[model samples]
Target: MAKRKGKGPTPKAEDRHWHGKRQKARAAKNAKRTGTPTMGPSGRPTATDSPRPSGRPAGARRAAGDSPELVTGRNPVVEALRAGVPGTALYVMSGTDERIRESIQMAADRRIPLLETGKNELDRLTDGAVHQGIALQVRPYRYAHPDDLLKGTAPLIVALDGITDPRNLGAIVRSAAAFGATGVVVPERRAAGVTAGAWKTSAGTLASVPVAQATNLTRQLKAYQQAGCFVAGLDARGSTPVADLEVASGPFVLVVGSEGKGLGRLVADTCDMLVTIPMPGKAESLNAGVAAGIALYEISRLRS
Candidate 1:
């Protein structure tokens, strides 16, 4: 048999989400008018439902670092520090590098513990990633409950479904903060958690915009609907454009999904409305971050 050929270098995390595909919009052969997922006879998930790397199963992408909580590298560490990512300690090795000294100074200023160790230990700490003799251990993120986001008379909340990328979560939080969203809700499992990458990309907005974790996203969405909140999920198959949402001025929850998979089956069904962002551009769809930003902007405009 012929040997398996290589797939070439992997794409970056930011570029992998719905970026490579450029085909024209095709009708969802099995999709219903409601845009719900069609299951196989055995009730197993379809090809789109199967867990694969990024949106396209053919191409793969690697994350920027070994771990989200342990931010490593000279530039990343400094940027995380500048972005005010909450940290417990700053690990470093003795070196004349100016960035290392600068990291030490910042850690000292922020009262983060400084743990000097050998290069070997640094590599081990970073899981053999390129550390450049520095790493920062981010404090474990504190997640909120779904109900805690219900604040004020008409609160807006953003819930993420199938969005495992922390950067996308950060971008959504930033949008949420701008549009007066109460907080963000994410599934406790199979979803992105607040991490150093999230903090950096959020530009510290995560601090103000608390992210709540839900054990069952579908249940939480139902609960929101029961509590008199309009639930909307962003999807390419949505009939109603986001700008025309009828319940914008009321208590609302906007759900965003991953780039490739869009909204999961049950989560999409849970939404009161599946809202689409009408993109007249040649592109077929937008990533979660961009989609959330546009949807939130439209919702805010409607509320205003």
Candidate 2:
């Protein structure tokens, strides 16, 4: 050899194997700390990247035991499940009730978590309401914008001016779904949003009906008017009768007022026509839901 001795001793096989193991351990630790997959040699996700099927995603599993809506009663829970409500879990009291069994089966069918708890816990979850030994934890409802209602195929829509009753809102939603109304619009403030009660009252029809919230109902009515929809306000002393209204066959927005007050002056004035459902008896008026249902029925009939 010509004195060319610059190379050091080659590493042993054991050393090389230990170094490879150390690198893999470090990579796995880093992956665990960052909650990401261990990158492969090509910097791509591998089979190890698959998350363990332990619990729900982060922030989805509520530890505080508070849910957005706790749907109580067997019928309500069953209907909610049938309506495809986004349920987190189903809580059934420790019993052998057939309804609870049905609920459990339904939840299992939908992959919804099922928990067996004491009746007292169910009562606590429902705030002492009549839970009927069952409760469903559902996600909050997401309301659409006023314009979304107008984009549907059906031009018939219902606008609630000041209806604050959640049941009425739910009934209106149910009626809207039944009568082929495209959607329902309510004011964003001073009115009822879709709540658990509304969902229950709607008999699961809330899933199909799109409810929109408007910043300014009068402005929304004006916008509907500009869009070639006849804005009609339901009132006692309206100019047009629900039965004889010619615009029912066309694109129309039926505006129902609050239970106590008929309609606001601005909203009533903004209407292209005022409609009254004829009552043969001396009853002054009807509830918001009944009135809306009647109007929807007449419109549906006219369209058919």
Candidate 3:
């Protein structure tokens, strides 16, 4: 069958409004979700219609000072909650296993906002890291000044020099708490801060043991020296054996260096005395955490 065209030539295909009415609806929804104004002063399109990669609200991408720390994984979340880590919200993936039930209960008991999200959304929030179906948004850790750590009549303090591993820091914090040490001092830069991993590794002792940050560790050690605290640097090669150290029972600052590199030159030179842990085994050295733990235990024993 032949049909005659009525208009001039065939009506050209016009560009359709791809966004159309749906785009406006989506923009309004997003504006409400993000707490943004839906329209501009002149009634222009002010709201964002584009979808976020992680499906999170636009308000989530706030300033660094306002952004929440994301602590993922079931065990970490549970431990952070148990340790009373300040939290803003607890997110659980829909259909998550029973492993996270305790975390849920803890969050509920603490009155933390509990949110259920899809697996993909959860993955986006954790930056594709293995979250194990749960994540906790916690506040940043507040660090004390080096002098503040020494204010109390604490006989022992542990200072970390270039120890970049958060787990090691956490272990050291835990060891210090167990040994009745006053606090831990870490460098303000080029060092591990009290992060979520550290919090988890501390096994809930972070709350009790204060962590202080020093702008200059060498200077801080010197200050400690002036305050009548002996500065003992832990190195493989030292003139004094940790066990036979005469100052073990006195107020002391035990400085532990990084595993790869020992203490910095200035830090090494600032020590009142260098001490070595006597190793009878064939192994060259112990892990930084293990070494710190051993030194702390010895100091505690001698003090006791």
Best by lDDT: 1
Question: What digit string (tens of lDDT, one per residue) describes model 3 on residues 77-165?
Answer: 77777877667677787535665898888888989878777787776666676788787876667888787777546468899999988
Candidate 2 lDDT by residue in tens digits, 1-304: 5888677888886677688888778887886656576666987554334222222222112212122566777777777676666776777875477777877888899898776777766555555677778777776677888888886444898999889888899899999999999999999888887876677678888888899989999999999988878888999979678878877778889999987898999999999889999888988889999999999898898888
**Model 1 segments beyond 4 Å from truth?**
1-68
Tell me the whole-model lDDT of each prediction, alpha carbons only: 0.79, 0.78, 0.78
Q: TM-score, each model?
A: 0.76, 0.69, 0.74
Model 2 steric clash pairs: none
Error of 1 at 163 (Å): 0.4
Error of 3 at 274 (Å): 0.4
Model 2, residue 190: displacement in angstroms?
A: 2.1
